[model samples]
Target: MSRTFFTSDHHFGHKNIIDFESRPFSGVEEMNAAMIESWNSVVAKEDKVFHLGDFSFLNRDKTRAIVERLHGYKVLILGNHDRGRSRGWWLDAGFDEVSEHPIVYQGFFFLSHEPMYMNKHMPYVNVHGHIHGQKYEGKSYFNVSVEHWEYKPVPFEQIRDSVAADEEQ
Candidate 1:
Protein backbone atom coordinates (compact mmCIF):
# COMPACT_ATOMS: atom_id res chain seq x y z
CA MET A 1 0.00 0.00 0.00
CA SER A 2 1.10 3.50 -0.78
CA ARG A 3 1.58 6.01 2.03
CA THR A 4 1.14 9.79 1.75
CA PHE A 5 3.72 12.52 2.29
CA PHE A 6 4.05 16.32 2.12
CA THR A 7 6.83 18.86 1.61
CA SER A 8 7.78 22.08 -0.18
CA ASP A 9 10.51 24.51 -1.13
CA HIS A 10 13.26 22.20 -2.32
CA HIS A 11 14.56 24.97 -4.63
CA PHE A 12 16.83 22.59 -6.44
CA GLY A 13 19.65 24.03 -8.56
CA HIS A 14 19.02 27.46 -7.11
CA LYS A 15 22.43 28.40 -5.86
CA ASN A 16 21.36 31.75 -4.48
CA ILE A 17 18.97 30.03 -2.11
CA ILE A 18 21.89 28.92 0.02
CA ASP A 19 22.95 32.49 0.64
CA PHE A 20 19.40 33.83 0.76
CA GLU A 21 18.13 31.23 3.20
CA SER A 22 21.39 30.51 4.94
CA ARG A 23 21.16 26.81 4.25
CA PRO A 24 23.99 24.81 5.83
CA PHE A 25 25.05 22.91 2.72
CA SER A 26 28.35 23.92 1.14
CA GLY A 27 26.65 24.63 -2.19
CA VAL A 28 23.80 23.83 -4.55
CA GLU A 29 24.91 20.29 -5.36
CA GLU A 30 25.25 19.35 -1.73
CA MET A 31 21.93 20.90 -0.82
CA ASN A 32 20.10 19.14 -3.63
CA ALA A 33 21.82 15.82 -2.99
CA ALA A 34 21.08 15.98 0.72
CA MET A 35 17.44 16.74 0.06
CA ILE A 36 17.20 13.89 -2.44
CA GLU A 37 18.81 11.47 -0.05
CA SER A 38 16.65 12.62 2.84
CA TRP A 39 13.51 12.28 0.78
CA ASN A 40 14.39 8.81 -0.42
CA SER A 41 15.20 7.75 3.12
CA VAL A 42 11.58 8.00 4.25
CA VAL A 43 9.50 7.95 1.09
CA ALA A 44 9.35 4.67 -0.80
CA LYS A 45 8.60 4.24 -4.49
CA GLU A 46 4.90 3.54 -3.97
CA ASP A 47 4.25 6.56 -1.79
CA LYS A 48 2.19 9.56 -2.86
CA VAL A 49 3.59 13.01 -2.25
CA PHE A 50 1.74 16.30 -2.16
CA HIS A 51 4.48 18.74 -3.03
CA LEU A 52 3.06 22.07 -1.92
CA GLY A 53 5.20 24.49 -4.04
CA ASP A 54 8.47 26.09 -5.10
CA PHE A 55 9.85 22.67 -5.93
CA SER A 56 12.82 23.71 -8.06
CA PHE A 57 14.52 26.66 -9.72
CA LEU A 58 15.98 24.46 -12.44
CA ASN A 59 15.08 24.56 -16.14
CA ARG A 60 12.82 22.14 -18.00
CA ASP A 61 15.33 19.39 -18.64
CA LYS A 62 16.81 19.64 -15.18
CA THR A 63 13.40 19.65 -13.61
CA ARG A 64 12.47 16.52 -15.53
CA ALA A 65 15.64 14.82 -14.44
CA ILE A 66 15.15 15.74 -10.81
CA VAL A 67 11.55 14.68 -10.79
CA GLU A 68 12.46 11.36 -12.37
CA ARG A 69 14.87 10.66 -9.54
CA LEU A 70 12.34 11.34 -6.80
CA HIS A 71 10.34 8.49 -5.37
CA GLY A 72 6.58 8.63 -5.30
CA TYR A 73 3.47 9.48 -7.31
CA LYS A 74 3.99 13.21 -7.04
CA VAL A 75 1.18 15.73 -7.18
CA LEU A 76 1.95 19.43 -7.29
CA ILE A 77 0.11 22.29 -5.65
CA LEU A 78 1.48 25.21 -7.66
CA GLY A 79 3.00 28.19 -5.87
CA ASN A 80 3.91 31.78 -6.73
CA HIS A 81 7.03 30.68 -8.62
CA ASP A 82 5.04 27.98 -10.34
CA ARG A 83 2.42 30.34 -11.72
CA GLY A 84 2.13 31.48 -15.34
CA ARG A 85 3.76 28.24 -16.46
CA SER A 86 2.08 25.70 -18.64
CA ARG A 87 0.55 22.82 -16.72
CA GLY A 88 1.66 20.45 -19.43
CA TRP A 89 5.25 21.48 -18.84
CA TRP A 90 5.05 20.39 -15.22
CA LEU A 91 3.06 17.30 -16.12
CA ASP A 92 5.67 16.31 -18.64
CA ALA A 93 8.25 16.65 -15.91
CA GLY A 94 6.65 13.80 -13.90
CA PHE A 95 4.01 15.32 -11.63
CA ASP A 96 0.98 13.12 -11.75
CA GLU A 97 -1.36 16.06 -11.17
CA VAL A 98 -1.13 19.81 -10.67
CA SER A 99 -3.54 22.01 -8.76
CA GLU A 100 -3.33 25.78 -8.42
CA HIS A 101 -5.30 26.36 -5.26
CA PRO A 102 -5.81 25.00 -1.78
CA ILE A 103 -7.34 21.56 -1.78
CA VAL A 104 -9.15 19.79 1.04
CA TYR A 105 -7.83 16.27 1.19
CA GLN A 106 -9.69 13.36 2.78
CA GLY A 107 -12.22 15.88 4.03
CA PHE A 108 -9.94 16.62 6.96
CA PHE A 109 -7.16 19.03 6.07
CA PHE A 110 -6.86 22.20 4.01
CA LEU A 111 -3.71 22.35 1.90
CA SER A 112 -1.95 25.37 0.40
CA HIS A 113 1.40 26.60 -0.83
CA GLU A 114 1.24 29.62 1.44
CA PRO A 115 0.26 29.46 5.05
CA MET A 116 -3.50 29.78 4.86
CA TYR A 117 -5.09 32.45 6.98
CA MET A 118 -7.92 31.15 9.07
CA ASN A 119 -10.00 32.09 12.05
CA LYS A 120 -10.52 30.00 15.16
CA HIS A 121 -13.78 28.75 13.68
CA MET A 122 -12.39 26.72 10.82
CA PRO A 123 -13.42 23.06 10.68
CA TYR A 124 -10.25 21.43 9.49
CA VAL A 125 -6.52 21.89 10.12
CA ASN A 126 -4.48 23.63 7.45
CA VAL A 127 -1.38 21.96 6.02
CA HIS A 128 0.84 24.36 4.12
CA GLY A 129 4.36 25.56 3.29
CA HIS A 130 6.20 28.61 1.84
CA ILE A 131 6.85 30.27 5.16
CA HIS A 132 10.04 28.22 5.40
CA GLY A 133 11.04 27.95 9.06
CA GLN A 134 8.59 30.52 10.35
CA LYS A 135 6.44 29.36 13.18
CA TYR A 136 2.66 29.36 13.33
CA GLU A 137 1.47 29.42 16.93
CA GLY A 138 -1.86 27.87 16.23
CA LYS A 139 -2.20 24.13 16.40
CA SER A 140 -4.54 24.14 13.44
CA TYR A 141 -1.78 25.20 11.07
CA PHE A 142 1.01 22.79 10.16
CA ASN A 143 3.99 23.59 7.96
CA VAL A 144 5.80 21.03 5.83
CA SER A 145 8.50 23.27 4.42
CA VAL A 146 11.90 21.76 3.82
CA GLU A 147 13.47 24.29 6.14
CA HIS A 148 11.28 23.09 8.96
CA TRP A 149 11.63 19.41 8.07
CA GLU A 150 15.39 19.10 7.58
CA TYR A 151 15.02 19.07 3.78
CA LYS A 152 12.91 15.94 3.75
CA PRO A 153 9.30 15.14 3.00
CA VAL A 154 7.21 14.70 6.14
CA PRO A 155 5.68 11.31 6.60
CA PHE A 156 1.93 11.00 7.11
CA GLU A 157 2.43 9.76 10.64
CA GLN A 158 4.24 12.94 11.61
CA ILE A 159 1.41 15.11 10.34
CA ARG A 160 -1.18 12.91 11.93
CA ASP A 161 0.64 12.98 15.23
CA SER A 162 1.03 16.71 15.01
CA VAL A 163 -2.65 17.16 14.39
CA ALA A 164 -3.50 14.93 17.28
CA ALA A 165 -1.20 16.82 19.58
CA ASP A 166 -2.69 20.10 18.43
CA GLU A 167 -6.15 18.83 19.10
CA GLU A 168 -5.20 17.88 22.63
CA GLN A 169 -4.26 21.44 23.37
Candidate 2:
Protein backbone atom coordinates (compact mmCIF):
# COMPACT_ATOMS: atom_id res chain seq x y z
CA MET A 1 0.00 0.00 0.00
CA SER A 2 1.12 3.53 -0.74
CA ARG A 3 1.34 6.12 2.02
CA THR A 4 1.25 9.90 1.73
CA PHE A 5 3.86 12.33 3.00
CA PHE A 6 4.31 16.13 3.15
CA THR A 7 7.39 18.33 2.88
CA SER A 8 8.51 21.70 1.53
CA ASP A 9 11.13 24.40 0.99
CA HIS A 10 13.91 22.20 -0.26
CA HIS A 11 15.62 25.07 -2.08
CA PHE A 12 17.65 22.31 -3.68
CA GLY A 13 20.31 24.34 -5.40
CA HIS A 14 20.07 27.57 -3.47
CA LYS A 15 23.30 28.06 -1.58
CA ASN A 16 21.98 30.99 0.41
CA ILE A 17 19.29 28.79 1.94
CA ILE A 18 21.87 26.91 3.99
CA ASP A 19 22.80 30.10 5.78
CA PHE A 20 19.34 31.59 5.67
CA GLU A 21 17.74 28.64 7.43
CA SER A 22 20.75 27.83 9.58
CA ARG A 23 20.98 24.44 7.96
CA PRO A 24 23.91 22.43 9.38
CA PHE A 25 25.32 21.29 6.07
CA SER A 26 28.75 22.53 5.08
CA GLY A 27 27.66 23.49 1.56
CA VAL A 28 24.85 23.42 -0.96
CA GLU A 29 26.01 20.16 -2.55
CA GLU A 30 26.04 18.44 0.81
CA MET A 31 22.67 19.88 1.71
CA ASN A 32 21.13 18.69 -1.55
CA ALA A 33 22.62 15.22 -1.28
CA ALA A 34 21.63 14.87 2.35
CA MET A 35 18.06 15.92 1.69
CA ILE A 36 17.76 13.50 -1.20
CA GLU A 37 19.07 10.71 0.98
CA SER A 38 16.73 11.62 3.80
CA TRP A 39 13.75 11.75 1.46
CA ASN A 40 14.46 8.38 -0.11
CA SER A 41 15.14 6.81 3.27
CA VAL A 42 11.48 7.14 4.30
CA VAL A 43 9.69 7.43 0.95
CA ALA A 44 9.39 4.36 -1.19
CA LYS A 45 8.82 4.14 -4.92
CA GLU A 46 5.13 3.46 -4.31
CA ASP A 47 4.51 6.29 -1.86
CA LYS A 48 2.91 9.65 -2.61
CA VAL A 49 4.62 12.88 -1.62
CA PHE A 50 3.16 16.34 -1.57
CA HIS A 51 5.89 18.93 -1.87
CA LEU A 52 4.47 22.22 -0.62
CA GLY A 53 6.89 24.57 -2.44
CA ASP A 54 10.30 26.01 -3.24
CA PHE A 55 11.37 22.65 -4.57
CA SER A 56 14.55 24.00 -6.06
CA PHE A 57 16.43 26.99 -7.40
CA LEU A 58 18.26 25.08 -10.13
CA ASN A 59 17.62 25.48 -13.83
CA ARG A 60 15.02 23.27 -15.49
CA ASP A 61 17.39 20.53 -16.51
CA LYS A 62 19.15 20.46 -13.17
CA THR A 63 15.87 20.51 -11.31
CA ARG A 64 14.53 17.67 -13.38
CA ALA A 65 17.63 15.66 -12.69
CA ILE A 66 17.22 16.12 -8.96
CA VAL A 67 13.53 15.29 -9.06
CA GLU A 68 14.20 12.13 -10.99
CA ARG A 69 16.56 10.99 -8.26
CA LEU A 70 13.89 11.03 -5.57
CA HIS A 71 11.45 8.26 -4.77
CA GLY A 72 7.63 8.35 -4.84
CA TYR A 73 4.93 9.94 -7.00
CA LYS A 74 5.26 13.65 -6.40
CA VAL A 75 2.77 16.52 -6.33
CA LEU A 76 3.73 20.14 -6.03
CA ILE A 77 1.75 23.02 -4.56
CA LEU A 78 3.36 26.00 -6.23
CA GLY A 79 5.36 28.10 -3.77
CA ASN A 80 6.38 31.76 -4.02
CA HIS A 81 9.66 30.72 -5.60
CA ASP A 82 8.06 28.13 -7.85
CA ARG A 83 5.85 30.67 -9.67
CA GLY A 84 8.63 31.45 -12.10
CA ARG A 85 7.77 28.32 -14.10
CA SER A 86 4.49 27.23 -15.58
CA ARG A 87 2.52 24.29 -14.18
CA GLY A 88 3.45 22.23 -17.19
CA TRP A 89 7.09 22.92 -16.45
CA TRP A 90 6.83 21.41 -12.99
CA LEU A 91 5.05 18.36 -14.40
CA ASP A 92 7.76 17.97 -16.97
CA ALA A 93 10.32 18.27 -14.23
CA GLY A 94 9.06 14.95 -12.73
CA PHE A 95 6.20 16.05 -10.51
CA ASP A 96 3.09 13.99 -11.26
CA GLU A 97 0.79 16.95 -10.52
CA VAL A 98 1.04 20.65 -9.75
CA SER A 99 -1.44 23.00 -8.11
CA GLU A 100 -1.21 26.76 -8.47
CA HIS A 101 -3.26 27.35 -5.33
CA PRO A 102 -4.03 25.77 -2.01
CA ILE A 103 -6.02 22.51 -2.05
CA VAL A 104 -8.04 20.60 0.48
CA TYR A 105 -6.96 17.03 1.00
CA GLN A 106 -9.01 14.24 2.59
CA GLY A 107 -11.75 16.86 3.18
CA PHE A 108 -10.18 18.67 6.12
CA PHE A 109 -6.49 19.40 5.57
CA PHE A 110 -5.76 22.64 3.74
CA LEU A 111 -2.51 22.02 1.87
CA SER A 112 -0.52 25.02 0.72
CA HIS A 113 2.95 26.45 0.22
CA GLU A 114 2.25 29.05 2.88
CA PRO A 115 0.10 28.87 5.98
CA MET A 116 -3.48 29.85 5.29
CA TYR A 117 -5.56 31.86 7.74
CA MET A 118 -6.93 29.33 10.23
CA ASN A 119 -8.17 29.32 13.79
CA LYS A 120 -9.79 27.14 16.42
CA HIS A 121 -13.25 27.94 15.10
CA MET A 122 -12.28 26.83 11.59
CA PRO A 123 -12.84 23.23 10.58
CA TYR A 124 -9.70 22.84 8.53
CA VAL A 125 -6.11 22.24 9.64
CA ASN A 126 -3.51 23.97 7.50
CA VAL A 127 -0.58 21.75 6.43
CA HIS A 128 1.93 24.05 4.86
CA GLY A 129 5.56 25.02 4.24
CA HIS A 130 7.50 28.26 3.54
CA ILE A 131 8.35 29.66 6.96
CA HIS A 132 11.25 27.18 7.19
CA GLY A 133 12.32 26.94 10.82
CA GLN A 134 9.50 29.08 12.18
CA LYS A 135 5.96 27.89 12.88
CA TYR A 136 2.61 29.36 13.74
CA GLU A 137 0.82 28.56 17.01
CA GLY A 138 -2.22 26.27 17.41
CA LYS A 139 -3.09 22.79 16.27
CA SER A 140 -4.92 24.23 13.28
CA TYR A 141 -1.56 24.81 11.58
CA PHE A 142 1.24 22.34 10.83
CA ASN A 143 4.49 23.29 9.15
CA VAL A 144 6.18 20.58 7.08
CA SER A 145 9.15 22.55 5.93
CA VAL A 146 12.27 20.42 5.45
CA GLU A 147 14.01 22.53 8.04
CA HIS A 148 11.48 21.43 10.63
CA TRP A 149 11.30 17.78 9.62
CA GLU A 150 15.04 17.06 9.63
CA TYR A 151 15.16 17.44 5.84
CA LYS A 152 12.75 14.55 5.39
CA PRO A 153 9.08 14.18 4.55
CA VAL A 154 6.51 13.79 7.30
CA PRO A 155 3.90 11.06 7.25
CA PHE A 156 0.24 12.05 7.00
CA GLU A 157 -0.71 9.86 9.93
CA GLN A 158 1.65 11.88 12.16
CA ILE A 159 -0.25 15.04 11.35
CA ARG A 160 -3.60 13.34 11.84
CA ASP A 161 -2.57 12.04 15.26
CA SER A 162 -1.30 15.47 16.26
CA VAL A 163 -4.62 17.10 15.40
CA ALA A 164 -6.56 14.34 17.05
CA ALA A 165 -4.49 14.70 20.19
CA ASP A 166 -5.15 18.43 20.24
CA GLU A 167 -8.89 17.89 19.81
CA GLU A 168 -8.93 15.78 22.97
CA GLN A 169 -7.35 18.55 25.01
Candidate 3:
Protein backbone atom coordinates (compact mmCIF):
# COMPACT_ATOMS: atom_id res chain seq x y z
CA MET A 1 0.00 0.00 0.00
CA SER A 2 1.04 3.58 -0.66
CA ARG A 3 1.90 5.83 2.26
CA THR A 4 -0.08 8.95 3.11
CA PHE A 5 1.96 11.94 4.28
CA PHE A 6 1.28 15.51 5.53
CA THR A 7 3.22 18.80 5.60
CA SER A 8 2.89 22.56 4.92
CA ASP A 9 4.00 26.21 4.85
CA HIS A 10 6.67 26.17 2.17
CA HIS A 11 6.63 29.83 1.09
CA PHE A 12 8.64 29.20 -2.05
CA GLY A 13 9.87 32.35 -3.88
CA HIS A 14 9.85 34.42 -0.70
CA LYS A 15 13.33 36.01 -0.75
CA ASN A 16 13.69 36.73 2.94
CA ILE A 17 13.87 33.21 4.31
CA ILE A 18 17.18 33.87 6.08
CA ASP A 19 15.75 37.00 7.67
CA PHE A 20 13.34 34.77 9.54
CA GLU A 21 14.52 33.17 12.79
CA SER A 22 14.34 29.46 12.00
CA ARG A 23 14.53 29.58 8.19
CA PRO A 24 18.01 28.72 6.91
CA PHE A 25 18.07 29.61 3.23
CA SER A 26 19.57 32.84 1.84
CA GLY A 27 17.18 33.32 -1.09
CA VAL A 28 13.76 32.34 -2.36
CA GLU A 29 14.94 30.15 -5.21
CA GLU A 30 17.36 28.39 -2.93
CA MET A 31 14.61 27.82 -0.42
CA ASN A 32 12.26 26.59 -3.11
CA ALA A 33 14.84 24.13 -4.46
CA ALA A 34 15.65 22.90 -0.99
CA MET A 35 11.98 22.30 -0.28
CA ILE A 36 11.61 20.34 -3.49
CA GLU A 37 14.62 18.21 -2.63
CA SER A 38 13.32 17.50 0.84
CA TRP A 39 9.91 16.59 -0.51
CA ASN A 40 11.23 14.32 -3.24
CA SER A 41 13.64 12.64 -0.87
CA VAL A 42 10.91 10.92 1.14
CA VAL A 43 7.78 11.01 -1.01
CA ALA A 44 7.38 8.34 -3.67
CA LYS A 45 5.45 8.52 -6.93
CA GLU A 46 2.67 6.36 -5.57
CA ASP A 47 2.26 8.20 -2.25
CA LYS A 48 -0.48 10.59 -1.26
CA VAL A 49 0.58 13.89 0.35
CA PHE A 50 -1.65 16.30 2.19
CA HIS A 51 -0.28 19.83 1.99
CA LEU A 52 -1.70 22.02 4.72
CA GLY A 53 -1.17 25.29 2.75
CA ASP A 54 1.01 28.28 1.86
CA PHE A 55 2.34 26.16 -1.01
CA SER A 56 4.37 28.59 -3.07
CA PHE A 57 5.17 32.26 -3.58
CA LEU A 58 5.13 31.58 -7.30
CA ASN A 59 2.08 32.36 -9.43
CA ARG A 60 -0.20 29.80 -11.05
CA ASP A 61 2.03 28.74 -13.92
CA LYS A 62 5.06 28.50 -11.71
CA THR A 63 2.97 26.71 -9.13
CA ARG A 64 1.99 24.11 -11.70
CA ALA A 65 5.59 23.65 -12.73
CA ILE A 66 6.71 23.20 -9.16
CA VAL A 67 3.84 20.86 -8.39
CA GLU A 68 4.59 18.78 -11.42
CA ARG A 69 8.19 18.41 -10.32
CA LEU A 70 7.19 16.87 -7.04
CA HIS A 71 6.18 13.27 -6.40
CA GLY A 72 2.85 12.07 -5.10
CA TYR A 73 -0.87 12.73 -5.38
CA LYS A 74 -1.23 16.06 -3.61
CA VAL A 75 -4.24 17.27 -1.66
CA LEU A 76 -4.35 20.97 -0.95
CA ILE A 77 -5.96 22.55 2.06
CA LEU A 78 -6.18 26.15 0.89
CA GLY A 79 -4.56 28.86 2.96
CA ASN A 80 -5.21 32.61 3.09
CA HIS A 81 -2.30 33.16 0.72
CA ASP A 82 -3.85 30.82 -1.85
CA ARG A 83 -6.01 33.47 -3.50
CA GLY A 84 -6.40 34.68 -7.12
CA ARG A 85 -4.96 33.24 -10.39
CA SER A 86 -6.66 29.99 -11.38
CA ARG A 87 -8.58 27.46 -9.34
CA GLY A 88 -8.07 25.11 -12.25
CA TRP A 89 -4.37 25.06 -11.49
CA TRP A 90 -5.06 23.25 -8.26
CA LEU A 91 -7.54 20.82 -9.78
CA ASP A 92 -5.37 20.06 -12.75
CA ALA A 93 -2.36 19.51 -10.50
CA GLY A 94 -4.09 16.46 -8.97
CA PHE A 95 -5.14 18.02 -5.68
CA ASP A 96 -8.08 16.15 -4.25
CA GLU A 97 -9.37 19.08 -2.20
CA VAL A 98 -8.89 22.86 -1.90
CA SER A 99 -11.05 23.97 0.97
CA GLU A 100 -10.39 26.12 4.05
CA HIS A 101 -11.71 23.81 6.74
CA PRO A 102 -10.90 20.33 7.98
CA ILE A 103 -10.74 17.30 5.65
CA VAL A 104 -10.83 13.80 7.04
CA TYR A 105 -8.38 11.18 5.79
CA GLN A 106 -7.91 7.76 7.27
CA GLY A 107 -9.38 8.99 10.56
CA PHE A 108 -7.32 12.20 10.63
CA PHE A 109 -8.41 15.85 10.37
CA PHE A 110 -6.41 17.83 7.84
CA LEU A 111 -6.30 21.64 7.81
CA SER A 112 -4.24 24.18 5.94
CA HIS A 113 -4.61 26.97 8.49
CA GLU A 114 -4.73 26.45 12.18
CA PRO A 115 -8.02 26.17 14.02
CA MET A 116 -9.06 29.12 16.16
CA TYR A 117 -9.91 27.04 19.21
CA MET A 118 -10.28 23.40 20.09
CA ASN A 119 -12.96 23.47 22.74
CA LYS A 120 -14.77 20.47 21.32
CA HIS A 121 -12.80 18.27 18.93
CA MET A 122 -12.87 14.93 17.16
CA PRO A 123 -11.34 11.60 18.13
CA TYR A 124 -8.71 11.72 15.37
CA VAL A 125 -5.81 14.17 15.41
CA ASN A 126 -5.74 17.51 13.55
CA VAL A 127 -2.75 18.31 11.31
CA HIS A 128 -2.02 21.84 10.11
CA GLY A 129 0.48 24.47 8.99
CA HIS A 130 0.58 28.35 8.81
CA ILE A 131 3.03 28.87 11.66
CA HIS A 132 6.74 28.55 10.94
CA GLY A 133 10.07 28.96 12.77
CA GLN A 134 10.05 28.55 16.53
CA LYS A 135 6.35 29.39 16.47
CA TYR A 136 5.67 25.85 15.21
CA GLU A 137 6.32 24.36 18.64
CA GLY A 138 3.95 24.09 21.62
CA LYS A 139 0.71 22.29 22.32
CA SER A 140 -2.93 22.70 21.42
CA TYR A 141 -6.11 20.63 21.52
CA PHE A 142 -5.10 19.08 18.21
CA ASN A 143 -2.59 16.27 18.50
CA VAL A 144 -0.26 17.02 15.59
CA SER A 145 2.17 19.59 14.19
CA VAL A 146 3.44 19.55 10.59
CA GLU A 147 3.96 23.29 10.18
CA HIS A 148 7.01 25.12 8.79
CA TRP A 149 8.76 24.81 5.42
CA GLU A 150 10.64 21.61 6.16
CA TYR A 151 8.20 19.68 3.95
CA LYS A 152 8.13 16.41 5.86
CA PRO A 153 5.25 14.41 7.23
CA VAL A 154 4.82 14.02 10.97
CA PRO A 155 2.69 11.00 11.59
CA PHE A 156 -0.16 11.03 14.13
CA GLU A 157 1.70 8.45 16.21
CA GLN A 158 4.86 10.58 16.32
CA ILE A 159 2.87 13.70 17.13
CA ARG A 160 1.14 11.91 19.94
CA ASP A 161 4.51 11.07 21.42
CA SER A 162 5.66 14.67 20.99
CA VAL A 163 2.58 15.95 22.79
CA ALA A 164 2.99 13.39 25.51
CA ALA A 165 6.60 14.42 26.04
CA ASP A 166 5.64 18.07 26.09
CA GLU A 167 3.03 17.35 28.73
CA GLU A 168 5.54 15.51 30.87
CA GLN A 169 7.96 18.41 30.83
Choose the strongest candidate by TM-score: 2
Compose the digit string of candidate 1's lDDT tens values, residues 64-149: 98899999999999987887677888898789999988889889888899988788888678889888878788877889989888
At residue 25, candidate 3 shows an lDDT of 71
- Model 3, 1-169: lDDT tens digits are 6877777777667666457635667677777788788888888889877777767777667877888888888877776676553556677654655665568655544354564444333344456666554353335434222334355665445556765775688
User: With candidate 2 superimposed using the best TM-score fit, by how many Å does residue 131's alpha carbon deviate from the native?
Assistant: 0.5
**Model 2: per-residue Cα lDDT over 1-169, one tens digit each:** 9999999999999999988989999998999999999999999999999999999999889999999999999999999999999999999888999999998999999999989988569988999999999989998999999988889999999999999999899
Return whichever of 1 and 3 wins on lDDT.
1
Q: For every model shown, what is its TM-score relative to the native structure?
A: 0.96, 0.98, 0.76
Candidate 1: regions farther than 4 A off? none
Off by over 4 Å in 3: 93-96, 108-110, 120-124, 134-149, 155-157, 160-169
Q: Model 2, stretches more than 4 Å misplaced?
A: none
Residue pairs of candidate 2 with colliding backbone atoms: none
Candidate 1 collision pairs: none
- Clash pairs for candidate 3: 52-112
RMSD of each: 1.0, 0.7, 3.5
Estimate every model's Cα lDDT from 0 to 1.
0.88, 0.95, 0.63
